[model samples]
Target: MAKRATVADVAALAKVSSATVSNVIGNRSGKVSTRTRQRVLEAISALNYTYNENAATLRSNKSNIIGLVIHDLSNPYYTELIAKINRQLAKKGYATILACSDENLESQQSYLHLMQRHNALAVLLCPTWDTSGEHLAAWHDLSPTITFLRPVGSHESDFIGIDNYQAAYDLTRQLIADGHRQLAFIGGSQSSRLRRQRLQGWKDAHEDAGISWNDAHILYCSSSMSAGSAAVMQLFQQTSDVTALVCYQDIVAFGAMNALHYMGKTVGGEIAVTGFDGLSDAEGWLPSLTTAEVQIAVLAEHIVDRLLARLEKPQEPPSVTLLHAHIHWRASSHGDVDSSHAR
Candidate 1:
């Protein structure tokens, strides 16, 4: 059996110092003559030499890799965001190691440890409901991290998310303007900040209109399609006067729409539904949904950019970026309402 080629052998064949061979193989931060680099590379190829990344990382103390932690990869929003993140990071010559938390804090913490073990330069996280700043702070002591989608309630890191409050506010106001006096909200876990924001927006819109808010109309759901379907049943059971419903997300709206169909109700003609996160399937629903379009791709790119910027300048103050939302009016809501005024 032939022995594996060593750096020394490549150096001897290229007629360069071992350090030059190391520089060529590792692409270290130093100027190596192009001719010498070519010779070393050629020698390495001819000798069938394989570079040890671990050994290279030990020498440079840099992994050139980023960790991406998401709560639910199965969600269409996260899936689309991850794809955009991958494309943006690839353009910067950085690779991402992705982990799904399934909205479990313990699983998310374990993935963070795994990233630490791999010497990740930085992490981009979409934390679970149970995640706290202290938990993130403990990890921040090990390396830099940026939170996305959901904040962990820590000032120790950066954050990027859509303006949930404003988006929900505008959507609800649109429904109100369309002659919907009795409005209902569905699909949100009581513990979610995003849910809280959207719910607050609903309240705010009602307050601005000088209409009394109804606590009974707000449904706390488990943030699933099934939960949304059940919530729709619950809403109708409790309040028969609700002419419109605002969902926390498109998937939830889809479920509620399905329930309405099951109950023999005409969606656009009798009742209206609005959803957030302008999901791909929104346009295909029985009555095309009116939704607040979050720029998922733009958010992904911004998060990556912010993470990289922090990597380059760790001492910089943490940044919190909130992106605006656009409303996509469709067949679900009445078309006569002036949607142009929606923020």
Candidate 2:
């Protein structure tokens, strides 16, 4: 097998010192002559040499690596957001180190430690359910961070996420306008702030319309397609007057739709369904889902922008940016209003 090329080989071919070569490769060649930089570049191409990023980071005490930690990678909404973030970071010559916490606090803490040990540039965290304000404050001491999606208990870091209350309120009002008085909420535990925010939105819509909300109609379940489907079946076994279901996520809505099909119920006809997060799968489902479309690419850009700004000026006060989600009306919910809100 042939041995791989190294920086030394490039330097030998270019007839320049190793330091000059490092300067050229690391984009610190402002002092070096352009002629010498061209020669080093030509030699690098000729020798097919690639810089060892790890070694470079150790020498300069800097990194082009960012950590991206999320609760669940299986959710398309998060994976799509990750892809957008990766694209934006790559443009700045940074790489992403992804970690899935699976909603486990211990696993998230371990990943934070790993990021610190690697001297990562920054972290874009979508924290788990059990993550507390103290954990975020302690982790920030180790490395700069930007939180998204799920809110940390305290405001210690830059935060970017959808306006859950506003989006859910808009969705619930659309359902109410469509003559859906008997409404149910599916997915997410009662302990979740996100769930509570959405539930409050549902109540807000009911109150605005002079309709009394029923606690019995609210269902608590895991944020999974299977769990959603099972929840629907279970709901029907006890009662059968639910005219609409406002799901916690697109995946959960998909599950409920599956259960409805199995139960010989007509979606968008007898029972309306709505979902959060306009994942790509939602559009292609049998009956296209009526969902709140989060601006993922825009959100990713803001996350990267905030992290880079913090990296440049760490002493600046932490801030929060809550982006709006637009409701996409479709056959699933038989909704006709097209609008959005930011708060």
Candidate 3:
């Protein structure tokens, strides 16, 4: 048999130090340049060298693995975010292990335990509504964890998410400017802090415009297409005066539009519809959706940055990073606003 290739052989062939070769193989932070990394990779491929990951884990007490625990993988919002996150992590030679909670607390806790067993270096979590501070603290003991999208109580570890209240407030304010007086907020459970922040934004917009927001118009439901459709149906059945529907997400907005079409109401003409989370398919709808554009790629980058930072400095103070989101006005929300307010 041919002699097995070693790290020394790779370093000699790549014309770099053994330490540089090790850094490239382990994805450790160093001053290795792109040119050197490429040469090391080429040498690795040419030599068909394989590092024993299990032995490495034992020696270093860490794995080249990151756990991603999220709610509702079925939602496009999360799927898009994961795509960006996967790309960014791969560049650093790390692999991701994904777990879906379906918004169930037991399932989420179980998945966290599984990640701990696998010895993941850290976790990026989008926690469920019922996930308590105590549960999160326990998970933090297993690994460095960062919460995203959905936030837990104050005592939870570091969090990275958009400014939900400001984004929602801006969208609502624009709809009001378009002469929508009788509005309805749809799709979100009352128990969620995210939902509450968004709801507060809508309420604030109404108050600023000197319009009374009716409690009857605030409909609390699951953030889904079916729920949005059902809620819109109920709203119309009660009264046809709701001229605009502000949905918690683009999927819910799609459902609302479908219901409106079935009811023979013309979206963007007879009644306006707006949504949050600027999804990829938003622009493809009959009358493109008006939504708050959360930069998924940017958000993913920030999330990875924070998670890695936590891993390096585990003793650092826990902090929150809130990114901004902007509203994109399209045909769905009537498209009649001044050109300056389009985005």
Q: Which portions of model 2 miss their true places by more than 4 Å?
A: 1-9, 29-33, 335-343
lDDT of 3 by residue, 1-343 (tens): 9988988999999999999999998677666888899999999999999897877898888898999999898889999999999899999878999999998999999999999888899999999989878888877877888999888876459999889999888888878888778889998887889889999999999999888898889887776788889999998998877788889989999999999999998888778899989998998998899988878988999999998899889989888998889788888887343343332
lDDT of 1 by residue, 1-343 (tens): 9998989999999999998998886687556988889999899999999987777778888887899999997678789889999899999888889999998899999999999998899999999989999889878988899998897787789999989999999998777777777788898888999999999999999899767768888988875688889999988987777778899999899989889989987787678889999888888887899999877788888898898899889999998999999999888876442233232
Residue 204 shift from truth in candidate 2, angstroms: 1.2
lDDT of 1: 0.86
- lDDT (CA) for every model shown? 0.86, 0.88, 0.88
* TM-score to true structure, per model: 0.91, 0.92, 0.86
**Which residue segments of model 3 deviate by more than 4 Å?**
1-48, 335-343
Alpha carbon deviation, residue 74, candidate 2 (Å): 1.9
Please, what are the lDDT tens digits per residue for candidate 2 over residues 159-236?
988899999999998788777777898888877888888889999998998878888888888878999999999988
Q: What is the lDDT for 286 in model 3?
A: 85
Model 3 lDDT-worst window of ten = 334-343
RMSD of 2: 4.2
| Candidate RMSDs in order | 3.3, 4.2, 4.8
